[model samples]
Target: MKRILVPTDFSEHAEDALKAAAQIAKKNGAEIFLLHLLELPNQMNDAVTNGSSIPEVMLFIKKANEKLQKIKEQPHLQGITISTTVQFEKAFDGILSFNKKNKIDLIVMGSHGSSGIEEILIGSNTEKVVRLSDIPVLVIKKDLDTFNIKNIVFASDFSKEIKKPFLKMIEFAKIFDANLILVMICTPNSFKTTSMGEKTMKNFIADFEVNNYSMHIYNDSNIEKGILNFTNMVGADLIGLCTHGRTGLSHFFNGSISEDLVNHTIKPVITFKI
Candidate 1:
């Protein structure tokens, strides 16, 4: 990979993400783009442009610059070229558009870009970006799994739809040299497929060369529980989910497995966008 993109807002949380991105880029021999989004406070721009309320906008811009400055001056970023950009709009959208126009191979951003009760009410832009971005997103948190990705738990049902995307996942696994735990959860009462059915399924997976892969079928009525049980069993450093664009009620009542995995697993989840 030639370029790595790290989006920031200058918060302590964001700084932590930048640090993780730097180490990953340094190890992978990739250039770094240290980006900051400037959503100017237009509502209060004229109100406090120069008034006694505080130099609100300029103060933020200055802080943003300082964040990038600290990153550039860091000893670890010596050879890695770091570039910065600021855009006046929504944060996630800006980063998404920039990636298409840049050499961005991966994105590293904070999990909770909290701005008060929003953090307690619902997740911030970080969760939204994870749902929308096609690239591999590493959402930083206070856990060793964020930096140490030696073990990967790939949540799959061995579906045929994973054919093309599975190749991409395999590519990542090879690069990271991470162990993949292939968990296939089945309903508790559902009997095993017949010998003939097993033969067909084996033949279906035969070409994937899953010799190193360990598969398990979790017997539980709750699919989410099955996934968590599997994740715990493998002690995953990262959880990989392959999305097929399920939305709305299907996601809610149907127990959107990917979304549930995010909430349940403390380990960083990598949802491979299909």
Candidate 2:
């Protein structure tokens, strides 16, 4: 992990994410790219170049640069290389652009955990990035003095489709030397016998040749609730998930279990695309 990208809106939640990323940067000897995206209106995009809105656009850019400069000079950033960028783009677009341009290894961002109508209406930048990015994204919801990923709860169905991402998840866990607890959520709609669940888990690990992991079958009304409940039960430090990246009416109606987990869970979530 040589480069980490931290996107901010200059909010307290974003600050929390920066602090967490700093801890990881210190440990891995990596540089942190602090980015702030100034989302401009559609009309203002062309206006910034040579039109009446030039002054307003310039003023906004100046203020954003000043904020980024202040953040770069913070005392906690000592001995850690911090690069800042203020761009004119939508939040997720800017993030993905910087990630590709800079070859970012990991992205650390903050979310306030939106759900229900609010989530449906506004959508979340963090969730969007998680859905689209090929790279791993770490979504932080709280401030941590140090990033000690001692225990990780990886919630998955243990199907053949998830095998690829599950391997990537293991590789990331090895970074922190964390113990992995593999859990499969058994909801009423997708109920399975205890014997079948255990058999499935055993075969999945054996076929993949995974080790140093524990397994569990958690029962709940839904997959999201089951994951959260089991994560809390084991006192996990991080949550791991695989996202399907569904879109349009299918996404709107059925929703995504991974996105729901990303929105509702306060714990840090590391998502691998499947």
Candidate 3:
């Protein structure tokens, strides 16, 4: 990884993401980009005149910059190369824009999982970014002092289209020298026999010359639950998934398994867009 983009709201959760990103950056000698989004009301959209921002908007930007400086000065981030940016846009849009402009290899962001009415009314920004970003996104939930990845549980259907993302997952695993637990979840709606599942997984991995990985078939009520159950059972440190980035009516009918796992699981999740 060359560059990592972290979108922060300056919450404790955001700090968790920063710490985790710092660990990864230290490992790879990558630069970190800290981004803070300033969303103004529609009436205040015209607050920028010529090149000067209005007083209120400027105040917000200034405070955000100060916070970014404090974050950069944190003990864990001391030796890392850090750059900061404050943008006047929605969180999701600003993150995507910054990543595109900076050629970020990965996006590491924290999310306080949403639920109940809040989730129904307005989904979290992390969910939106993970759904759209072409690059890989790593979602961190809690603070991690070490950010170690000993075992990664990668859940997939072992289909032809998943090969590209599966390869990406393997590359990530190699970074930590982590063992890969390749699982195929069998739900009632899409059930598969153990023999069939094993054969399919074998055929899928046969194309690649991957080592230090094991394959298994898990059964549960749904894909998300199956993945989580298997991850917990194996004590995996990270969860790898491939997102189809479904939207509109398509998403409504066929809910996103990757996004759902990102929200519900406390374990760190890394998603690759297929």
- Candidate number with greatest lDDT: 3
Superposition TM-score, candidate 3 onto the true structure: 0.90
Per-residue lDDT over 107-147 for candidate 1, one digit per residue giving the tens place of the 0 to 100 score: 87765422231331144666556666666666665424247
lDDT of each: 0.63, 0.78, 0.80
TM-score of 1: 0.77
Q: Which stretches of candidate 2 lie over 4 Å from their true place?
A: 50-53, 113-122, 207-211, 247-255, 258-264
Between candidates 1 and 2, the one scoring higher on TM-score is 2
- For model 2, residues 1-274, the per-residue Cα lDDT tens digits are 7799999999987898898888888877889999989888777887865556577788898999999999888888889999998888888789999999999988988766444312421466765787788777887777777778989998877878778878878877777778899987887778888999999988988866555689998898888778888898899999987777654111211335644554566678787777
Clashing residue pairs in candidate 2 are: none
Cα RMSD to the true fold for all candidates: 5.0, 3.4, 2.9
- In model 1, where is the ten-residue run with the lowest total lDDT? 245-254
lDDT of 2 at 171: 75
State model 2's lDDT. Answer: 0.78
